[model samples]
Target chain A: MDLILTPNITDPDGFYARLIAAHDGLSDEESAALNARLILVLANQIGNAAVLEQALALAQVGK
Target chain B: MLNDRYSLAFKLYPYERSSDQDAAQPVRHPVVIVGGGPIGIATALDLGQQGIPVLVLDDHEGIGMGSRAICFAKRTLEIADRYGCGRPMVEKGVVWNLGKVFHEDRQIYDFNLLPEAGHKYPAFINLQQPYFERFMVERVRELQATGTPIEIRGKNRLDAIEVRDDHVVLDIMTPEGPYRIEADWLIGCDGASSPLRGMMGLDFEGRVFQDSFLIADIRMHNDDFPTERWFWFEPTHGAGASTLLHKQPDDVWRVDFQIGWNVDRKEEMKEENIRRRLDAFLGEGLGYDIVWSSIYTFQCRRMKRFRHGRVLFAGDSAHQVSPFGARGANSGMQDVDNLGWKLGLVLKEQAPESLMDSYDTERCFAADENILNSSRSTDFITPKSKISHTFRNAVLQLAEKHAFARPLVNSGRLSLPCVYDNGPLNGEDALPEAPARTRPGAPCPDAPLADGFVLDRLGGDFVLLTIDADAPEQLDVGGIALRRVKLSVNDDATGALAERYLGGATSAVLLIRPDQHVAARWAAFDESAVRRAVGHACGKE
Candidate 1:
């Protein structure tokens, strides 16, 4: 499943980068799974639409 | 009457004359601690607890004055518990749950340190340091009464120390006369202006911030302020800085003001000026009376090395940081915790003296990180220049309005404990792919056990926890003993912890040492593998 995740408002890339970095030694499937789990946790923490928009913008920039 | 009380209080005579010293000479203890402060008393307590004889020589007749180090972190409480002192400490201390930051009259940020679900103690407790020291001294006396023979030569001063290959000899000056003492190890726990550190010719290198702070213990009636830490940011007073208000025991409040460098030190500390600042921040016409006040300069400095041959340094003698996040004394007590068990092992012949090198390595790492964070906070509070001030204020402003910025700003970088990843005891597997855990190099996270006791309950010594539900494997390492306990994976709390820490995976076993560092861990419940990992870390074949 292709999943699109948004970041938190302050440093969306920072958390995403940390998640990716923690899983850097894992297999491609493992990294993707971990990233998906982190996205859910971050989404639960920053539940605001404005923050979600900024996070989405940050993710796009990283891409 | 006094002699009758003294005789009744003791099981045996304390001051027995040794044959080695007759009328010609007096008996000298093996180790003589120079200062009677918390650090000195703690060192003596640790050594005495291990059956080693020590005489603490203090210039004061009683425990030192002042309520210094009123804040104790969870990690420190773990250490105190190991020394059989944590119960009283917890009973007397005031645990804080929330902290608020205000700018002018508006609430800028409010953070809650919700007790971690599995941890026994809260994040921090505020207690008077003098009471804590007295408790330690009384514990020492109790040990002495039981023939443990921990001596404290009050009104005694250290004149000189000469280090030899075998022992460190101390020349002490007492009220009666001069004496000499020889010790296997000499520890300097004296404050930042440590004479021992200076005598050893070691350099304490770091930036000394020009800003000075005023700490006042006062009695005030503020019903609005809950039993939480309140920080007033950018006050109109001397250079837009911060003010701290912390609740103490017995209706007393400890307040700290970050007075800028512009104010003269002499004029800033005047009683009238201090009262004025207290009134301004606490609101007008609040019936408040000042108890005691003092001015101090904040400096972030650490010795180039913690150990120089036989002499070791702990507490403020080893490192100094600004009192922004209460890292200074907490980290020093942690230094004692790290060194105590290792020194005990060496003295007991369980481990070689070479193990002492890890104390320097581990504590230096902690000190370095503390200096970095405290320096950052110091810079944040007292910006060196206009550009720096503008930048800091801009970041804080951004943090105020943005949720993302809030966590980033309050990363609480100062409070985070740094593990020794590259220390002697930390092996090749120390560099784990997973995030941090309660491991050898890292401080143990507070975990709640099924019995209602927290993970910190197991911290006084080495603990072996089995996460596997079936057929828990048990194997012994060479010299390091392991106490095995079954962690029921079926419990709801265990399931949550497995999800949070192990990424929803199981079958891992963890071994933690008394200092709350993860000594070893096995991905799968393999007895032989766990034994080998423990053996390697403990320097046993």
Candidate 2:
């Protein structure tokens, strides 16, 4: 499986706005649940679990 | 002030005898609902709304007394709303979508449930079971005032049921004595310790957790806590395991503290023990009064089949899951949603009796899904093996620092509506590129419409929803007598409906069943295709 490392944002501001809009009126617990679901859906679309693990490891660097 | 004439602020309803046992003849009814809990009453009200006469039998007269089953999911509220009791719960219940996970006071991750919008109800609400039951009773009484009265015979315990080939004969023990009643169909919503199931020798099979948790409902003058569900794993307060905080209506805050299985039940439930635990959960020196506290052990078990000849089971009688995910009442409501319309149609001879089997195949599948999730949560929370505990601790530690590990930490999976993808009732869709979210088997996703949401237009009958096209004048939908609803969609008025239902296509028609599950779909309007799908859905094929 190949990971898409290209610059993917068409409208960064719009994407940022949509991301913020998703969190609107949601509490901390609900936000956590939403994040979990997001990770899962994105993982399924990504298809390859090995690539997902690598991407997750990369994203978690220096956190 | 405590005189007999004085009006009490609230009182437990006195059980009244609805049947005179001395009467010579046996009373006959179309439907007999055992146990008048939320599930039974909801089913009764739903059936009654469709002009079906139902008799509800229960040992208790009033609503449940605790702040039990606190988290009502969006799907449940939607079903309640459709059945005439949803808005009140949303109005009064604490509607929240955020949650914070703390592994020993360190914040891990947060989530938003309904991120992409278009739903009328929130993702979840913290409404107690009592309020839900009261709201259902109110709806039943309100319907009764308008002449469609569902007879609820309180204090009438179903002593024994003699199952017949055609119908069921129930020997009910009332406060006045015993009486025999006959029913064309008997629905057991009698809950976890269902005597009806016991009488029929049906056994519930699944996992039972070895841990018992103490739920304390506390009332205080001033207690400030966040509305979101706050879950703690090995926190500074309380003894190990997991703890949860949820605020119900009124000044009551429900705190669940996991107590190990070996402890004495009575000793643990003592006021001093409860107070000590509360001190650990909330800080010491807090001014609060204990409203109610109960110790309960959760088990995820279910019957092999919900349907038995002329007798059907709904709610806890059919399936029970650990209370962590709020799956019990929510799933029961889904059972009501899945079964009510089919049962009503079958009683009316609109659909074949075999249509009822779909209820078993569909809901039992849902029950298994719920049980599996709840069991996983239980194992995570109270790890049995040494390696399991180490792994849980490691996950908790890593979750605080990483985004990926955050999803692995299971406080509770939380209840979501089940998608019946592989059920026998669904038809094969021809269009592969169509939106799978609203596919043939999936529960119809709530899309924004001009008048109301898409699901609001469904529920009562077989609806043919056409997007960016026109439905034919009429469909000769075979021998089945289902009321066909034609919803003509104009995309210029509503933006999301076309994108959500039709995908990129210009036109499509979806055959939505009475329970709001999509039975079939078509790229274009064809009468023969629609009729075949409808026939298949109603078990007429």
Candidate 3:
């Protein structure tokens, strides 16, 4: 399956606000955990281990 | 020992005032509810309020003995609000949304469930289940007083169920003797360890939790602890296991201690052992009096199917989850919310019987979601495997220093409403660029309407939310109620409704089902479009 590479999110600001809202009032460590859980949730939705590995590699390249 | 709440033996009042079962006269009704708990009575109230005749059978007489299942979520309160039984619960219940999580006596993080509120109800109410059940029971009684044709037959235990082609025959054991009654539809709200489930030869299958926990509600006159949920993982006081504390109404504080699995269950429940443990766990001297105490083992299990020919199951009979997330009774209430209206419409011949299939499909999906979250929470708290324990500890360690790791620390992901995405009952999403929230197959997000909340406008009918446009004068609902209201830009003072539902569309029409789930949306109204959407929502298409 191909990855979603296009700019798909219509309202980026709104989406970001919701993402921040989900982690609002959480401490920095808690925020990190929330991000980890979010990544895990997305990875599970992705389901393909190869795609997950490739995505992890891509995410690591920028960092 | 029975707690103070159950010591008086609540007046049962002989609900079945008269019975023809001993005479072997099989009385028929539209619906037969087989449990008298909160879930059962809530379903009966919802159905009875809609003019659907129902007969409820319960083995016990009055409210449950102890304060079990105290936390009621906002979505459940909304469902109860629809039936006029939720207000008293909210008034008397302790409302709280902030939850504080700690790791070994160090404060880690806190969460606000509802950051901003445009909705009618708060995020949750820490009310005892018996009080909520009593409210629903009184609502049913009020409906009965109004001649809505409902029978609450206490002590009429369901001994046997004979599921025929189109109806159900129930053998109920009454105070005098054995008798039978037939019903067009049978609902088993009979809780976990449901006799009805066993009678039907069905199995509750899933992971069996090994660890045991002691839950106690104690009455103390301390005002130091605020109204919030406090959770500790491996506290010095708790001796390595997790603990949860909450302040309930009537100066009662609910405390949970994760005692190990190998301990003697009965001996652990003894007052002496309980007092000894509480002294160690709470750190407060012997001032507080224990109001109720019970031991429980967690399990994340559910029935394979919610519907069986003419017999159906709701609440614990259909699904059972650990008590961490407050999902048990809340999900049970949502079960009735999904089934009640469809059953009412089907009985009235307004909607096809096939609509009930959507209940099975959507609710089973929700049950799976609840099971998954609950299972994950139990694993995080207990961590059976070595690697799992290492990962959990690392997350907790990292959570103290970084914000991202904080979300990984799950004390118990408090209950949230399920969004039924892409279900069979959802009408087509014909309008492109529509908002994500009010998309087809999702519960309509609560918004501020004039003088009330959005859910306050929805119930007992298909509501068409027309924005900046006049409601169509002519549309057929096929004997089912259809409500059409026009909300102008001025009507939504806060603009939360417009931002969620109408994203720059001058005139958008949304078709919502009776359960307040979005069935379809169109940029413009068309008679045939509405007819088709209604057909699909009613499961006729």
Candidate 4:
């Protein structure tokens, strides 16, 4: 797979809450570390290098 | 009822009494079309020019007033050209190829739809829907003068239809009274609110957007705006959430404002309210007359099947999409283009009735594609959720300086011809290295030939086109003659023909259909393979 940018989430609000709760009691440095680790895990799960590169490029667009 | 703005411009088809009214029994015709709109008239022109007698019944005496569906794509013009009426449309239209997108009054990026061209028509033209219909009706009248056997009865409305296995019985309501008529086949182009579809008890299902847009066409003598499509998202003028501006002919401009979902439609369409919005967007004291205004809400929906027994549906009666990409009328013309020849063949006994099934399969596929695209554009333009809105704004802001994010900023994808990727009528595709744009199940792209254009000669019949490839001058398979058109890449002044038709292959042979879609293509011509592909295209295999 390719990067699917459409609205594919089944429960967006619930996922958002869960994501926010993950950083609950962590320092700023810990929260940044957690975000880094999360990105790596998802990228590894995707597996395809081209798709990972596309996601990387898209994430860096506004920067 | 047509508004008093502009209805008496041309009474193209006046209500005239026909001898069929006084007939002892119901008169049986080969084909009867309901709706004198562009699609119905184009279908009539297609069938009548092929010597098929057609009768068109319309509720109105002439075209209704409105500049609805202004952007006609290139493929639509090409199809109209084959119907002998593309000249006036292209001539009278205000052609536009450039589009600019702005985010909150800051110009982000711009695009040119036709950067390189060796084609006959532009990427798109902005023409009012009424003029488009009037030109086609004029073509019908011209063909009638030469006795082509196409009759359009004004003020004739289809009250009900009885679909039979072999024919359809129609009850038409005229001003004088109602009359009964029998048709071998009935075509419904009666538009989105199709009475024929309603009477048949069909399901038209899809997504309805929770948004509304107000269209105000104004007339003023000024050169303030260029002939380009300009779109803005959350304008600084606070006109609306989003807005679009386009220039049409005769000093008229089409302005569309995305008025939010929960508003009084009547209050929004008031003259003073419209003027307020226009004044904010265009600046005060512009001094323009409101030619016409309407508030519209769109849905991305379509029927389950375009064909049901003897009655078939073309145009908006069968499908609909948000007017974002201008896919409504353009796709409808393509439906007529695809169905016209297949229906013609079935009527002539040259092809089996099963051929009509391909029309349903292919046009439905096209409708789904159109719906998916327009829906995506709508979601981008009008974000439903907060997170989605943030993403949209971020994409737009990044698009100003970042090339990578430019394609992500979706104002509207714009209308393009749909390719039947997995259509049932498609045959073998042996030219693996050939350009995918000219491969099987794709509409043939036009190229400038020595005489004129490639599309000018390919449509209206089966063409066996050979480029640096050897094939018979003519091939007759299953009573269908495939005329050979031999041409070389040297015939073109530019090398666009070779680039579009042949990628790396030295020679190519393409079997083109009557609608100018590539049925099959091969590196070399094999008589048996050609015959089988021809048979397959005719629904004989």
Candidate 5:
């Protein structure tokens, strides 16, 4: 299953940025796996199908 | 009992020839503060900075142990900045703008603290409390270095306190000998079990939870965790199940585990018991030594009143909270911040002593709100009944799906600062009815100035903010020192400036106090009303 993650400006950026920054140091496969996990976790958090759809669209555009 | 661990050497003067000589000897400083802990030191520092002579008495030969309060809020930093400690604190501290909330191994929400860049200071910084104290002590020493005459009497203990209307007499037992000193004011910054508060017959009213938490400082080598705070709710640990991991300086981590109250008091804090909990979380084979470990029960309480006569209560002596929200130390520092400048003003006779009453009114409001939020958070985490457990689970489940539920579910209430709506100092004409987005009573929200520094960075004393000039000359608010800045009246800049300094505003004039709370604000400058409000707040009228 595919999942998407959307970052909000109001949410604390320090924690999220640090997490992403740490992920940058990982190997591509490791980073991809972690990203997939994060997307699933965030998608589970959002719960709304429309919001998830928007997040997925944004995720694909980034890719 | 006064061995190497607690020895003192005193210089004694030769005995006088007559009783008249002893009687004629010059009096020492009126007030002598005992304990160089943050509270004691802060009181002495504020008094000394106000040109009042003070002798700080401490038993320890040097500073205390461990990091203690590593999280410095923007408001606390602003207060420290006033005594020339803020810059050094900001310099040495690690600025963090985010925190991640986790449910066991799953990440529920991530918060970005750096929402807008215009504020002078960041949301918070992680700095060891000892170093922060050292910075404050150095500032105190610098004042003395200039021959300002503030003395820190270490290796001394308080034997007795005698309260007199004209002065507070202290019987201090030093290495030299027993001595008597007197002071016009006495402040207790002596922690939760403050002797001074007890001496004044002030009752600390609040609840102490039965559950105890063990805090362990460990050197972590985890690659997955970021250099940010992580809270794991209902972790698969012991009977009481939550874990808090916070990043500190020097690659150290402060982790807290909630253990139920039923454990044997003697054996519950043992290394074996601690290791068992650590093993449950980190799994086997992760080698790390616990630098420090201690267990403490959480208390949610505040003194009925912060002041009685010239004696004032600050920090833990005045109020306390569960460590669940990290509000305890931060709130204490805020008490010092609120009381420090006012004490300075009153000591200098610039403001009436009645202004001191606002400290009780304002700080009590802050303390109560902090306790309420922290207690609520504690209850949510440690649900007491099956119904509460179900409610909590349902909220979490809803938070996973609803954007509207995220703030409540993620416990953002803990992070939001309290506003003083019903404060005696707040005026009816002031923007009291402003929405939460544009609240008039809160500490000015941090925002970036066009000059690149944050607006909050300009704090440490009263600030005059002039958002726009529908009538610039009409902006005169008497009795309050005003600094005026003109920005676009109706534009995004107004929103940005409003959010930064006063939350949200189209055009207004704001008078910000030293503690960063909005002392008075006007939708548009009505000079006389502003002056009257300032007069009312400062007790000049």
Candidate 6:
């Protein structure tokens, strides 16, 4: 199972706004905790281990 | 019975007047090493044993007090073994390979540094810096007694130096009076606060972490604590933020407390205050006497260039790192190992002067590697920002339950010798099928031979190590002779040599440098290729 790197989300800006709105009323630590849980949830959804590893490597690149 | 800086282990080289001090004209020596610390003395031993005349000058008469650098890594021992002084150190040192890490009051994980067998030395030995120096100094004395051209003058301090195109003229201050001497080559092993570096108007460039650690070496007989490194983060004992405990030789233990910055250093140094903290940490029942104590703030820094004209710096004189990893003295020993052969070859006119530049190149690269690892360890140990602290704690918390996060928990990554992978002196790494541990530019991994170890056969000269392979008995390339050390799998009783050297391949040929770094290797012997590698290693290519 390959990661869908292309524009897969039909409402990209709407999803990003929703992601930001999730942390709107939270403190930095609370926001960080939320992000961590969200990452785990999203990671579980993308259950393919190799694809997740590749995604991690790609995300870490050029930082 | 507290031993301070004035405490002496061996007053080996007391103040003695030399005839050269009364010479009408300043006497010129082949090589003069400043600061008779471990690095300086090791450099002298390396050069002196190679039939090179070297002089060592030190301000102090002998080893200073305290177990300053108590952790001697295997590589350092291996290098010392090459100079014929490792056995005493290992005999007198407290050897340990296990380290247990704790988060708050709970043990998160433990690590064994060397899990496998067949290596000559242990993972690490906790010997006091004074003992380490004494062993090397004893070796120096033995060499001198055997008529090796090595002279050590205690109380002879280097006051000033004049650097020229080919030589260095140094003015000395002694208990008697002032004297002058010149050197064809000068080495600055003067340590972290290098007087020679200051005399040359040079300074290190890097980060200074805003934290201080207090090291207390106490003589205590405690049956509860095993001979292993035990570290605690956010220790529940009402001590400092973090604490370290290790066993040394002679019923001594070194305890380090990570006292935060912006505190009165003098107040912290007071014995009553120190004991107040220690008593809280160790509890009241334990009886112990303070052997030595010192406060240290580390900096991960290095000189811009290790080599400046005729002057060369090794050890702390060249670079410094946080003591977290034991990289400080271990890396300095490596610098001596690297520079000794290069400098020897240049002095003998066997290798080009450009080969000396590779010392700067390789060691500066190594220094940066040390600085990077130590700096990262420091950052992890003492997180600067709140987010970093949160992440650090998070990693520790997760490491308690998850194996994946255990690797991320950095409680000072132990010192390992740096591989000069991209070294300019490295030749073709043709043994792609062989073990990467024995690849070109990597330090030769020790393996058990039938009677002894593989590392014992190498060092001090070019060795053409061929395992289950055929090569010429010897090859002389550009006046440098490569002696062949032929070994077969049948000779390897434990099969470690075969596994470490050959891997999947049946045969291997490796050209090892005098420093025991693999210059190049092949699946089979090839004369021209070996010659090319030797030439390349000598900076002729």
* Stretches of candidate 6 exceeding 4 Å from the true structure: A1-63, B1-7, B221-224
Give a tens-digit lDDT track for model 1, residues B72-118.
Answer: 88777766766668778888888888888666456777878776665
Error of 2 at B468 (Å): 0.9
The C-alpha stretches of model 1 lying farther than 4 A from their native spots are: A1-63, B1-31, B147-149, B221-224, B237-240, B408-414, B428-435, B452-459, B469-480, B490-503, B524-532, B539-541
Collision pairs in model 6: none
lDDT of 3 by residue, B1-541 (tens): 1122233225453545454654556887779999888888888888888888888888767776778888998889989988888899999899877788888868877777665568788878898777888888778778778798777887777888888999988887766777778999999998998999999899789999889999888887566667888888988775339888887878788889898788788888888888877787667564788899998887899999999888889999999998878899999988998999889889989888888888999999999989877876787788765445655776677566555556566666778767788788888787777688888878877889778877787765788878776667446678755678667667778988878888766667889888888899998888788888888899887
Tens-digit lDDT track of model 5 for B1-541: 3232422222111122222114444254545665677767776776676677776766555566676667777766666766667788888887666777766556777767554554566667777777778888888878888876577766565667777765677665555566566677777777787766766667998997878788888876664557877777776544248787787776777888778777676786788877788877767777777867777887899999887777777888889887656686678777776777787667666678888898888889989888877777777677655445544565555455544445555342444556888777765435543445434456666554554443434445555566664544323343334555455534335355555434444556676666667767677767677667666666676
Docking class of 3: incorrect
DockQ of 3: 0.04
TM-score of each: 0.81, 0.86, 0.87, 0.91, 0.78, 0.90
In order, what lDDT does every prediction score?
0.67, 0.79, 0.80, 0.88, 0.66, 0.87
TM-score, chain A, per candidate?
Answer: 0.55, 0.80, 0.82, 0.91, 0.61, 0.90
Q: How much TM-score does chain B earn in each model? A: 0.88, 0.94, 0.95, 0.98, 0.85, 0.97
TM-score of chain A of 4: 0.91
lDDT of 2 at B81: 84
Of 2 and 6, which scores higher on DockQ? 6
True contacts kept of 6: 0.00
Q: Clashing residue pairs, candidate 1? A: B118-B447, B118-B448, B439-B517, B439-B518, B440-B518
lDDT comparison, 2 vs 5, better candidate: 2
Ranking by lDDT: 4, 6, 3, 2, 1, 5
Which segments of candidate 4 are over 4 A away from where they belong? A1-63, B1-9
Q: Could you say which candidate leads in DockQ?
A: 4
In model 3, state the lDDT of residue B527.
Answer: 78
Candidate 2 lDDT at B297 equals 87
